[model samples]
Target: MGQSFFDEQRDQSLVKAAIVAKYFDAWSRVMIANAARGIRISRLAYIDLFAGPGRYKDGAKSTPLMVLERAIADEALSKLLVPMFNDADPENVASLQSCLDSLPGKERLKNAPLILCSEVGKDAESMFTRARNCPTFSFIDPFGYKGLSRGIIQSVIKNWGCDCVFFFNYSRINAGINNDSVRHHMDALFGSERISRMRAALIDQLPHEREVFVLEELAQALKELGAEYMLPFRFRRPDGSRTSHALVFVTKNPLGYRIMKDIMAGESSTEDQGVPSFEYSPADARCPLLFSLNRPLDTLAGELLSRFSGRTMSMKSIFESHHVGTPFIERNYKAVLGQMEVQGKIVANPPAQSRPMRKGERTFSEKTMVTFPSRAA
Candidate 1:
């Protein structure tokens, strides 16, 4: 939480492990649903791009290895041709081998089709090429953005109809853009100048919505990669001080979106409500559940709006003022704005240049504002 590498690593491992389990459960449920509908997927393959050590330092199990073990033991999933496990760390590779060896059927490890490499992205690409004909799911959980590139993702999804669930470090990306030293790093990670343009636009138009801009840009990139739908979820720390993690699910299938929304809804205990409602309104109605375990969007938005005294404010200013991260802003702020506009509780003003912040020879400005309804009692 304090930006320490060990702390970050530990937090990420826990979040990734939980996410891996969520997907495993979701995938199993999906398979069961398909079978109920008379459709059977005889083969299933999984790929982990950043498969870490096979065991956590605390002796907790590794997510990638756990998934492999479950797949091997599940008669339904084991019927699949084979599954693949990958990691970039040599120690992790050795650890994974040891763990697999200790499993019930050591010799049957071959059936799982495990591969360990120093460069997981390259290996993942090669693995995708080899399994081009089979349905695959790839988990891209890098320590940072360097391990995954837009091109590599495009290749994997395009070459093999693979669906990806990725861990996007919004905080890191935001910090990178805000700081001048890492500006060039953005182009390398995102593969375009558009990120700069969007960053500028966000700083200009909806300064308060900087986090929203990041989420939108990320979702748009996923769309460009051919994923028709995405589900973004945030994980928070226990103290509720900050967002520790964010997960995004990308798939080209509408059914995948429907299923994800349904699964998320069920997980939220929302009682099988149609699609997870995205509706937002200023008036107090039942608070809709946010996908995050920490900061619910409604709570954040309400608190922020109240702080502004329900006055009209620009999106950019709002984002900067609250320090809300991108995932939260994108998923919740827009809906809150939409609800306020509909209820006539607030009105949007024409975009205007934000007050400048001076640093060196440059001036930074933002656009986006909100005004309270004139007739509101």
Candidate 2:
């Protein structure tokens, strides 16, 4: 990003930073909590390869600074968190170092924040592909798709507790698909054979359809590499024209996936009849319509009814089992299940009172399991 982007910290970028920082806090806490309970976690690392100037020109802190500050705030986190910030640009590195130097109580962190001025390409990929000594939370944000590759993502999240969040420049990569000059970069990104197929498949497709196809292709490839859970938070252009980029979160743990989905959903601009768009549109600006009568939940309800026709599970279990590749969050599931219980479509019980829910406790919480009607019923 340029100084201009840092000038005011664009709304969309701010949203992106918020999602990452929130997830980092939540994820790191889980690790620390588990270790407190005797789980083995010797160290934790937060790596940002394309770390920009730590503080924006307008005085707001970006991801790198925000992360370090959080570590500084918590004693337990300070003991376990090791943050590394790297940028290919010398100017950014210099600025970021200055900011890091000025951070109050910087030495409280386990490791002095490691700031590097290095390109994120072959050498970096090679380094990350090897076995990691500690569980790391990596954030890969590039101005463009130049330095990012599949191997880096695969390697970062291949371990026991490692997770990755990367900026996917859809607009740029889509345009560069057939451009011969950047073909090598494209090959590195999607693999040579996959890129070829993408070019052929994208022929005569509409812009939006092509965008969906490309995102899915990348997600599918990541899954093939064993990154089981992936969630995307999309950003629209300043003019609200089309998708400009997205922050894609990859993880192997269901808990991590659930955490990110909630954070991203909270950052979303609008909810359609209670279902979030999973997008940040500058035009939307977090505003709600005065009145919305649409019942998109009807569609979700039907899908759930069909899938669980004769089944039963905890709301939490149902969520983990169902919401991998879908946009529906946990709240969405609870809302649908609650409605189904009321309308006699299915039975949602808290597993103890009212017959289950303890006389008056009727919330569809994570522990509350629900039973669906049999096909014969």
Candidate 3:
């Protein structure tokens, strides 16, 4: 599966690349801009520990080359971008180095791409202990649950501006939770104490309940490790029969969380009652049958109304405050707010006078200052 993973860019793979590249670009821009004003951030780095071959057999480029392409084109990034690619496979490292060598303007890069071939468990000592010089963005995408550990994440995110996005193989973990053979790996991933609690809790729970439990446990572990924000984007199998894996992004910055949320929301293949599902399900592209009358966003909308009753605030403020534990993104909040507006529940300053429509109805945005009535009218 390692080599075949880069066979061709599938839906989930495409989504992963999109999320990582887009967020990396956004993260670099912010950190660089902040550094200009004498912020603590001095530079930026992009590390892909499980980086596969740079391109697919069909000539599709993977994340490593995609990121280097961005650096080669931008003069500022070329000067500050530290591009590093590593894979346990020697063949992959060779191929990635060759592909990276072909990138135009690679010479302008401040540091040539650092390509490595070594076992992550053996060679990643510095990653688990040493502090990075710059604000590093790490993509730890292991095929299974072998090399990823809580300390690996705990280390990367300790820096002021550092952040990490790792592949969380849920299916592997769910199967390994009780299996004694891989107990140590699971222990390392979630810490021994946390995994013990997780194992005890998983007993007698339904499948759905188990999923929620594990996710909550992960959130708790991330918090304990100093990751203030952890966002998970799940990917279902092609047939949508069962879960496949997920990409979990962790950061200490709320702004990073917000930027990554928008990126993940865009790739969601399904939306429940108008809220992005945050999972890619290729089987049911539109998932019309599943949207049933649950209208999850309606509940969220009401909760917001009650929480900030009679108070005026920007949509941005509402999103920042209300979106931490919820699946609703800024767009989802805007959708529900637009519904409330049309129903006379809330009012928006500088109302939608011009082009604005979603499913032939008006929508809201972050900039629009909105006022919630003292009570639902």
Candidate 4:
């Protein structure tokens, strides 16, 4: 029997959405961070190359659409003069249209534009052209490697120099690499005689290591297309058993690299050290939530620390400086403070009372001073 259009492949679909959401969350936090730094993005565009049905059949979260909505609702993002969205699938287009229709007001969506395309390969370039002058973000989440052609990607990045997050299916590609019949297809996708070179490089490596070669080749391809910094993040199932997906971020800007590093570092820190197997349960896992939750806090905390380096920073000062809400500040405050304390990088002092202390009077308030460590030490 031929494969169904809606295959019951829960693992791949769920993992892909989860990973895409992670990058979306990272993008949100980075936008917030940029705003805090007074970096104004007059316009921003989000393009999803292989946008799915917008919602999952398994009740798993919607990714590119959800991400777009979240960003649009964010006050920081709303200030942008333009925000555009694009998707390839007809079902997805209907889904997004329905979603947009349900919004309370059309005025709220005036600046938020969306386009649905029947043919992605032919239309992606034109969409990018429309968003050429803006700082754009394109999410390329294809089932296989075919949805995004080299020429299409080259055109988008060349015109917009946009930041991109791509889902590369290394497992599928690796599985087909040794087949004699598919060599031409692989050559078209990879756009090089370097397939032979890549195969040679992977011959001596382990099965797992071969995946890394695919990722590296993809990264190299993006770099050749003008993305200055490329970072690949691997995502596994909740039980940590096997790598389910790889999220690759390509950016021409230094700040994108900084944000990606912070997000990756946070993910690493939250990961359980010395775990026996990569096998992970979708439930009761930290890494899955790490990408969604802790990564933002990690990025925010790092930014806050960098801004206040060599200076005493109060809790209020930190919150104000970062433009973060009180709840977020409270939840992550101690974690950042604790991390700084462990490194002996911050000092805490009790605030003195203005009046004389009585038996029931609170004599001091908790305050913290953060400072960078001396190089000689």
Candidate 3, residues 264-315, lDDT tens digits: the string is 8888887776677788878775556865557787698789888999999999
lDDT by residue for model 1 (1-377), tens: 11222234554455457655666656655665675687655556677765666677777777766776676666566656356666656667777778767766434433655666645446566766766665667777533434456666765556334577776666677677656675555665554667768666766754336666677787777677776667776544443334445677777664555455444433332221122322112211243343233435546545655667756667666654553222333324545654555556565554222333344212212354677543334
Candidate 2: tens digits of C-alpha lDDT, residues 20-116 = 8999999889999999999887788888886788866667778988898899999999998878777777899999999889999898987787776
Q: List ranges where model 3 is wrong by over 4 Å.
A: 1-4, 7-9, 127-131, 142-149, 350-367, 375-377
Flag regions of model 1 displaced more than 4 Å. 1-15, 28-42, 106-110, 142-147, 158-161, 178-185, 202-208, 262-377
lDDT, model 3: 0.78
> Please, what are the lDDT tens digits per residue for candidate 4 over residues 273-318?
2111212235434445533433454565566556676676566566
Off by over 4 Å in 4: 1-42, 58-61, 71-76, 79-89, 117-119, 142-147, 155-161, 179-185, 203-205, 237-241, 264-377
Number of the top candidate by TM-score?
2
Clashes of each: 19, 4, 0, 11
lDDT over C-alpha atoms for residue 83 of model 2: 80
Q: Compute the lDDT for candidate 1.
A: 0.57
Q: Residue 47 CA error for candidate 3 (Å)? A: 1.4
